[model samples]
Target: MKVLYVLLCCVVLCLNVLASSDEEDDKQLVEMERSADLENRKRLHTTNTFIKKHVKQRTVRGKITHFVCQNAVTMEKLTFMFALPEQNFNEDPVIQHAMELELQREMHEGLDLTEVEVADLAYHEKNMNDLGSDRRVMLKPDLALLILDIILNPTNYEHFDFIHTCRMIGLFWSVKDPTSFITNAEVTPDDNTCVIHHGTTVVKSFQYDDDSIVYVDNVTHKVLNPSFVLDLA
Candidate 1:
């Protein structure tokens, strides 16, 4: 009984010492990594201001995007740019993406959105991104993000004096084409409304040659193009 007791005590002490040593080693590694990260962030700040202003970078693989508003008054339209560094540690190909974003500004009189309406809105937003899955273009949003509304007495349009459903979607787009898959797509206002499939995508230019084909180059299925022409009334 006495030998068994001593052996148990010895084992417990050994385990405690091993655990403490492992914990200290982990702490030291974490501290070193944090110091390195801080230095990298400082370097990034000094090196690029565009990313600092627009993107909230975290770790080497993640970024939090900010919306670039078109008009402060009517922020119905926006654009955004995401800079992805290649060689995260210096071996990957860095790519910068720019795209248009849309948000609706409606004037509903005493109308309350039902559960279905809210679900539909979420579905539409998700569908927008899903439609572009083939291009590996995904919008990674920030955790500490919010959508706030400001009541505006819009005088331009009659019959409405107060604003309720007003939320902004922000993005940025440029022409010096970053991605290889790109072409021009346009949605013109005809007698009827154009149901744009991917209006938020960055386009090269519109084709007057054939409205049926949105964007075409030397070959087929090689264009970052979409259609606003849907068979509707």
Candidate 2:
């Protein structure tokens, strides 16, 4: 009987130790998770600060009304429009000269163009003479990088307002079905509407109003209304 009691006590003591160890493990896990989350937040804050500082230094003016990007591997194309608020073009020679210098620096660092090719392209496409002309300017890849940078990393609506204000209207078509895609689309900036048509049939439509932007899915026949607020700073 005394031996039986001793065995029972030992078993109880073992269970108590196990329970305490499990509780301690759970507590350590929770603390590790909390520390990880805090570190992630700190890293995010640092990254955002760095991006904002750089964005402020680069002066990107003018509204990119339309942009087209193509995937190199798939040959898929993305054509989009933005209803950006108009601003007077900056004609300050100092700012223009500074922009030219920056463009030269970026070309040297980012592009694989020779010095001669760079000068020729910059003169023809990005010179102040062509920029000030009344005709529409065709931007080459080198100059387009500046606009793409602003579009990708926007600090405010004034920086690039499309993500917040406009609807993303995309059409996916391959070389097989090229004729079925939209050949011509009209962008009405007054009402903020872009309607893509295929042989008189409305393929995709996006409309924006005061409170929200509405997208009509032709495939599902469903309506999506996403709310947006214009941040004009």
Candidate 3:
């Protein structure tokens, strides 16, 4: 019994010593990696030849609207616009990416987000990325991630609304395109009475340095009368 007790005590002390040694080793490794990353960033920033100087940039803007359907019972319309920054046509791809990231950070600051939940839709059930599976992929070949959002209580119209039910679904891929996705949406009220409101929402985004512009336009019309309510979804 005495021998066994001494052996157990030695084993515990050895384990504690090994654990402390491992902790020290991990700390040293992290510090080394952080130092390396900082040095690389400094080198990139100080390199004067990284980005070209004194180049011409072009800014293009346009707007278009179309009526998909117009009838007494239902009406749907679409409109879109874009305002691209003045970027040198032959700018270095890396520098262009840095500029876009800076712009995105500036735009997202102080932005408000609506609460959303994951929606259960039939199309989302199958494994779309499985090459051997029978399910068909719904996105483009270069798309690495996709998200779908659905308003839960879309019919419940309110003035100066504070909250709304929504759903967001995300899909990820092993490989993705190098482009960033940006979108904006707004809802406006017309007048009060037999409330007839016509609002248009525009979604705009910039593609990668090599890709073209992308946008989405949506126009919605709703009439809330004494005995009838027309909602848009």
Candidate 4:
């Protein structure tokens, strides 16, 4: 009976020692994990600090070109008026083609005459808008006359010159017209004051007018000028 009790006590002592050793091992594993986490956090913070200290800041300079015309431009529908030189007005195919190329180079960018009917002088003009919008405009003989009248040789002299003078009298809708404009959730308008709105309008309408209208940039009205004016006469 004494031998049995002694063997039972030995077994109990061995089990207690094993339990204590297991607890110590668990504590060491937890400390090692905590040390690794602290090292990772320190490395992340150091990388962020290095980026903030060594990163270079850049500033972009924008050019602001103002209009020269001081002749109180009244708001109206966009219109241009000019008379073509008599020589280029005739229905010579070669001359017409040259005139078309000149107009494409000066006024219309990416202008392609997809269909040209020589008999009726009617054609379809596929063009790109300033905002990279694509449009195909069908121009009849009558409408072609109006467009050519303004864009053709502006000097109105005996010899042929590509540069022509034209008068533009109208308010152009820079933004989409109320009828066709789709609602954009991204555009947020400033509701703060009129000053912000006015500034935005001035920036949008810069160089809006053609070069024939505003000849020289006048310093007096440099703050707000919309047209590209020139005195060709």
Candidate 5:
């Protein structure tokens, strides 16, 4: 009977020791987590404060064709006026594709037109998936303040040039060749804001009015810009 009691006491003592060890381990773990969270909070607060200081406040809208002096003296801004129809404003993809076709048509004045079925088949095959546009994306103002801020402020940017820029305006347009764009466009004061009467609705006009040419560190491929102000009203 005394031996049995001794054994029971030993087991209880062992369990108590184990429980205390487990509680200590849990307490350490909780402390470590609290320290990490506090550090993260500090970092996040600092980052938020830093970013708030440099954010730009002003905005300029509309598509821009530009004539900036090589020495960064006088920069000229010009935009064109287009009479876009109501249908073009509502169904955006149709309007976008139509613009590209218009560019091809303008560039290829003498080429024969393809049948609707053939063109549709080619388009569907090449573009299998369509990314639906959010109303916010369509509604985001083509504000030029971000470009202005980058030029004026230089934390992420070390170098910037006020280069001559022009736009052959259309809905879905890319620089034919950025290298060619660098030296190819001639900007006389007279035709800088040109009006090539490609007519409204049918011909679909393009405008280049603004002096906001976006450039990266060394690469010429641009991913984003505050270009093409969409006030198609």
Candidate 6:
């Protein structure tokens, strides 16, 4: 009877030790998760602060020119815009450097462009440069700034409604080669009308009035689309 009692006591002690160890593990797991969450929040706060400062320093200073083009062969429409500032905004060099670094990090970690598309962009850029095209070359920093401006202050842009749905941003270069699908092009001024021609033959034409560019709300201070901003963030 004495031996049996001792064995029972030993079993109970072993079970208590196991329960204590499990409790410790659970505590450690919770701490790890809490630490990770805190770190993430800190990172987000830093990014938001930087963006706010950058936006304040650089408001859309001048006219926004909207461009829409269509590929003749594929009929795929490409739309983009350029915000031409009258004079260079005097921004702090430190802020500019920080913004560039942050944008570079994001591009390195979260690039969504496919390899083929990237190759095509490079090829077109090289071809245009070789042919002495005078069009503005879209740089990485320019694209990042453009996106920030659009998301923050959509009212400054002409076609905010159309721009919100754009899959790609930045300048689109046309290849001058015979095999290029983007051979024919059209330009619409403030009148909002376009006529595309193929060697003196009118192939396609379209028009978009002021009604087409509608603003959902007039909140200039807040981000127009949180989801879109988060995707880029």
In order of appearance, the predictions have TM-scores of 0.30, 0.33, 0.25, 0.25, 0.29, 0.34
- Residue 140 alpha-carbon offset, candidate 4, angstroms: 52
What RMSD value applies to candidate 2? 19.2
Better of 5 and 6 by lDDT: 6
Worst window of 10 by summed lDDT in candidate 4:
59-68
Cα displacement (angstroms), candidate 4, residue 136, comes to: 45
lDDT, candidate 6, 3-44, per-residue tens:
999999999999999999999999999999776444433333
Kindly report which residue stretches of model 4 are placed more than 4 angstroms away from their true locations once superposed: 56-233
Tens-digit lDDT string for candidate 2 (1-233): 99999999999999999999999999999999776444433322322232233334442122212232212211112211111001111434343333333333532442345656543432222222223221112222222344334344456335334432222222221111234544334455655465566547766565554334456454443555542111110
Q: Cα deviation in Å at residue 86, candidate 2?
A: 33
Model 3 C-alpha lDDT per residue in residues 1-233, reported as the tens digit of each score: 99999999999999999999999999999999776444333322221111111001111000000111111111111101011222211344354335434433332233332222101101222221231121112121212111111122324323212111110000111011102212222223341111111223222211111121112122333321321111110
RMSD of each: 17.6, 19.2, 22.1, 26.8, 23.0, 19.9
Query: Model 2's lDDT to the true fold?
Result: 0.36
Candidate 2: lDDT of 118?
40
Candidate 4 lDDT tens digits, 1-233: 99999999999999999999999999999999776444433322322222222221100000000000212211111110011111122345355334334422322222222323211232123211211121111111222332233434444433322111111111111121212211111111232111101112321211123422232222222334333322111
Residue pair clashes in candidate 6? none
lDDT of 3 at 56: 10
lDDT of 4: 0.26
Top candidate on lDDT is 2
Candidate 6, which segments miss by more than 4 Å at Cα?
59-208, 215-233
lDDT of 5 by residue, 1-233 (tens): 99999999999999999999999999999999776444433322322222222222111121222112233221111111111211122345454344434422332232233545223322111111111121112212222333344334535334322222222222112111111111122233542331111222111222232333332112222323434333211
Per-residue lDDT of 1-233 in model 1, one digit per residue for the tens?
99999999999999999999999999999999776554433323222332222233332112221222222322222221222221131222132111211111111112344545533432222222233231123232221121111112224323321111111112111111224222121233432111111235533222222323233332222443453122110
